[model samples]
Target: DQEGRIVFSNPASHRIWDGVGIEELGQYRGWRAETGEPIAPDQWPAVRAVRHGETTLNQLVRIQGSDGSEKTLLNSALPIRRADGEILGAIVLNQDVTEREASDAALRQSQEDLQHSRQLDAVGQLAGGIAHDFNNLLTGVLSYCDLLLQELGPGDPLRSDIEQIRHAGKRAAMLTRQLLAFSRRQILQPKVLSLNSVVEGLEPMLRRLLGTGVSLAVELDPALAPVMADPGQLEQVMVNLVVNARDAMPQGGQVTISTANRELDIAQAGGIPAGAYAVLTVRDTGVGMPPSTRARVFEPFFTTKEPGKGTGLGLSSVYGIVEQSGGRITVESAPGEGATFTIYLRRHAGPEGAQAKKEQRKVLPLGTETILLVEDETAVRNSARRLLERHGYTVLEARHGMDALRLLEESGRNVDLVLTDVVMPEMDGRELVQRLRAERPEHKVIYMSGYTEQAITSGGVLPPRTAFLEKPFTVDQLMRLVREVLDE
Candidate 1:
């Protein structure tokens, strides 16, 4: 067939190449350059197959059609031989590998996306850990700074310095809080909140932040359900997503945000638990992400933006919030094709299981009650003892939980409140609470810890109504919390 003549062609060849199907099967058997102008018969695979008495394969050479469009062929030819070993024409085969090539490319892209996602997850964990510890330190510093301001006179220079310290500390605390949110380690005060409402409330701010050049649109499903999560943290999630969308569109593009009610069944593929959820999606028409960048988008501190433009923790924080709230997230993007991020958070069934609203009561004086305070830090314990003694209460000091227990056993005095650290060398707050409860069941106890409630106790080990005061407590917070617990 290679003597400038065609041999055999599959029926699908016409369907694939549009027309040049069976008509030219045996008639058009010639080797042509991919240019399709014409090739000498000796240079053709089919011609070589017959002349050299050997098979030949055309891996992926493009062939021109009647319309000048290129068609790729995986062509193979074997010499057709007679019974006495005399060579005849060639039996050629052609397969269209266009769709197969496309599928393979898509599969490669998907694998790359998966790998990037995993890397981001690892980075988020690291960032969250750092934020968690930094938050604890900030909590102590900020609380004490506020307390210091109360002791300084209005005209004192020390008061101004303390105020500046408090302001700076507060800013640092906010950064740490963002980190904690990304890590899912912050003390959460979850509530039943509608995502639609949160978005609506943030619409004005988002529009302003996005500026006049970029357009913003919102699509809200009326049937969208509520999710159980800290309202502040949820708001933070929305803000971060909006900010990310804005950054993506520096050249000016549309940012669209939408929410809907979604249900993930057991067979769903997104690693989401089977449940009803509120789906939040943010899409940007800015510079779309390439396969390489999309993979690490959610990794903490992993950003493709020029330095000083990003911390790379925006998506990571979003990931942490959704995950911690029993939700999942998925991203879709292609190079120059824009991006869309979808977050699925478990829907709250109305407001039935919401944590009780914290009711603020009037601060009262800690009458003549004796308080036993156990702390390891010299400065903190001394400060606490002085603050309590000044508040008209008798104070007993112990360096550790064990020392406190010894004081309780030896001193026959009636101890009204047992304030102890949740983490200590001799005995933690949890063990001390158990011991005190066992010895004197009626005693009041206030536990303090910088970690989350889960981090402080293993499982559900702590008893109900056991008051907690997070550390670096101000004189008023400590006295007020103690008084409230004692009064109860």
Candidate 2:
């Protein structure tokens, strides 16, 4: 068997092995393709074919070249025998299939990514539906609670109980908001803002949230440009990131919040458009995530924290907010190496602007205007009617848009304002308004809903100067909005 060595190799075989000839290849090492264990000389395909007079077919093997490069090959060997039943040598064939294996692996990874995305989207849709229905129920409870509070005396014993109920309802409302945020269904009021200012404003609260164990550092860019985003959503994003970092380092660590200006090319921006962006980075010196955990970190309801400790929607909501704001988010981490989350927001071509000042609280004005209230939900419709009637307005209730139109046509009364739910059966609020506008262009209208469709909103916001009222509004909110619309 020629001293248990390869005696000859064809030009193709030599070329496949990086120009190493048969004699030179004899010194190369081989390994099991699956487990990477070294193969002994006797265990090699050629050795078994020649020395043991055995035939082998299509065995996967990995060979290491002299330059430390590896190639996966499918090999076959057959014993060559002479006339006297003597074994001459062996013929071996190998095909380099490194590229094929790599391509298959990449395809599998792409499929997995697609499946994961679909799963997240399904969960988001479910969450949005649930939140929408919950908001309707909450509107009744909150409206009733506000009415009771308004009727109670300052010294009434039942006032405390009603206040507690109101507090719990508010908390539930907050949870619904979080769910809507994760589903990218929540309404956003985006404004041009300086990222550095937002970070600075939240510093005091962040420090308090981190407690005594964790330290906070801010490195803001002095010349950072303004970004168009919902200020409240951005704050929520920061709070979630900081809280996540703090939890990662239970024993405490330093959290650094920074901002910078970046101009990304197509390749660097991933699916987002290539443009100038304002970058917000949150880095922590806490235990980080492995590849497996990192892959699913943004999936809705996926959490590493124990039950009752985390909602698991923080990162998911963050992802939705950034995406809805026309931006992208990325994370860099490895096991025990800490983590860095970067948010890239498209730069707004405008000067930094101050946040809108909070309106001074004034006593809600009562109106005697004839208002038509249209809603599909009976409880919500009745509660709104009572609310408006208690404030001295003559309210006409309708089960839906068609009923409202019929009521308008039958009654010769000139309705001062039409307060209608945006989503309804038979006729949506938009269609009803369109019809009403045709008949009476000067009629005032205010659309209300837990969630509005794109047809009603431009870029997730109500049309400019259009009146709108979100569901679960308090008595004051309802009264003020009604009065404001009527005045306009």
Candidate 3:
């Protein structure tokens, strides 16, 4: 009678364990009645509590009971104590939480799946809209820069200023290209490139950009293998990182860039593929990112800086480019401890070195050959006219596609090129191109836009090799693209 067991189990546990009576509980202590099998002693909470002289809870075990059915149980046990602190025995409690656990696991998995899907969808939509608008802006900047360069005299007082304008315009264009690259919407002309060579080439420009107050250091590995990527894009990534670092420092600080050859093993790194990589690390001594900022740093339009200070696309574009290039980027930062952004790119097993040559665009001569300029924006059209005339071309101006066709019909002027805007009020650039091709196949056409190359080229928006110029372009870009189109 001293070993008698009592039955006052919770309703939940009683139904789960199949424990019916007080005597039955003691008799089936080491067994499960549902499955007519014995329980593993080591896994029994009651045994553990009694042997260890302590209580245990939430311990899981698989057991069979009287009906020969298996059930997973989450159990707890406690030693029954007397008023004099003597341990009488143990009280065992079990709950079958198999269904609950399974349901919880399934729900968690579904949520993760849903979140991933939403992120991918969001990225795609954003990439499309961003690329289109970015290309347009680049087009305008490059075109104008080109035009300005043509007007400057070699020893003119404004020559340096004009050159700087050209340089800044080019950088903006490069930024747009990065946006396109990150979106994987830009056409890539990848070549084998040594990391050391790329960094060395940018030393002068980096020095100029960082200014005299900030220190620039490069710790490139001589043994680093070549990587296959667009050199311009890679340079862009470096510049963007450097610029961000510069902005982080109010009083100026050191920006350290290092590149080394390394291999990523699947087991070693969770996300990046196993391969040889050119690990590029950019570190700064400025204020570091907080956890909240770090989490959203790679999201488009997310920035901590004041409005008008940054476009917030720099890091996001960098993230896109790295991801699109079959590489991975990771950031490390601690509040007030500065920050480091590490980029891992798959290395190409090739040549040890050669400095990448600066691409020189061979500017063609402007001729008296006529060009019909069609643009709705008054400022843009005036600039185009001034730019074309300055280049010694007989320029014809029209406000829209219809007006352009009318000028051609009325004047019967020997038109050489139809320079038109892509987006218009009545008939679009693409439509204008079609009408021209049908009516006057003799005259060549060039399309200009702030639209990304992908958007303009897709869905037969613009024909192949039918010269396209991006909006806000400098004079030189306009002339070259125009000449290139005309000569075609």
TM-score, prediction 1: 0.69
lDDT, candidate 1, residue 389?
Answer: 76
For candidate 3, the 10 contiguous residues with the lowest summed lDDT are 453-462
For candidate 1, give the lDDT. 0.70
Candidate 3, residue 162: Cα displacement in angstroms equals 13
Model 2, 209-312: lDDT tens digits are 99999999999999999999989999999999999999999888999999999986653423445789999999999999999999889887789999998888
92-160, model 1: which lDDT tens digit per residue? 667876677567756675676567557656655675656545655665576567557767788988988
For model 1, state the Cα shift of residue 94 in Å: 9.2
My TM-score estimates for the predictions, one after another, are 0.69, 0.76, 0.57
Model 1 scores worst on lDDT over the 10 consecutive residues at 453-462
Q: Which segments of candidate 1 are over 4 A away from where they belong?
A: 1-140, 204-215, 265-270, 273-275, 305-309, 335-337, 348-374, 384-397, 412-420, 437-447, 453-463, 466-488
CA lDDT, every model vs. true structure: 0.70, 0.83, 0.70
Per-residue alpha-carbon lDDT of candidate 3 for residues 187-242, written as tens digits (9 for 90 to 100): 33356787677789898998798997789989989888888776766787788889
| Top candidate (lDDT) | 2
Assess the local accuracy of residue 150 in candidate 1 as a C-alpha lDDT between 0 and 100. 60
- lDDT order of candidates, best first? 2, 3, 1
Model 2, residue pairs in steric clash? none
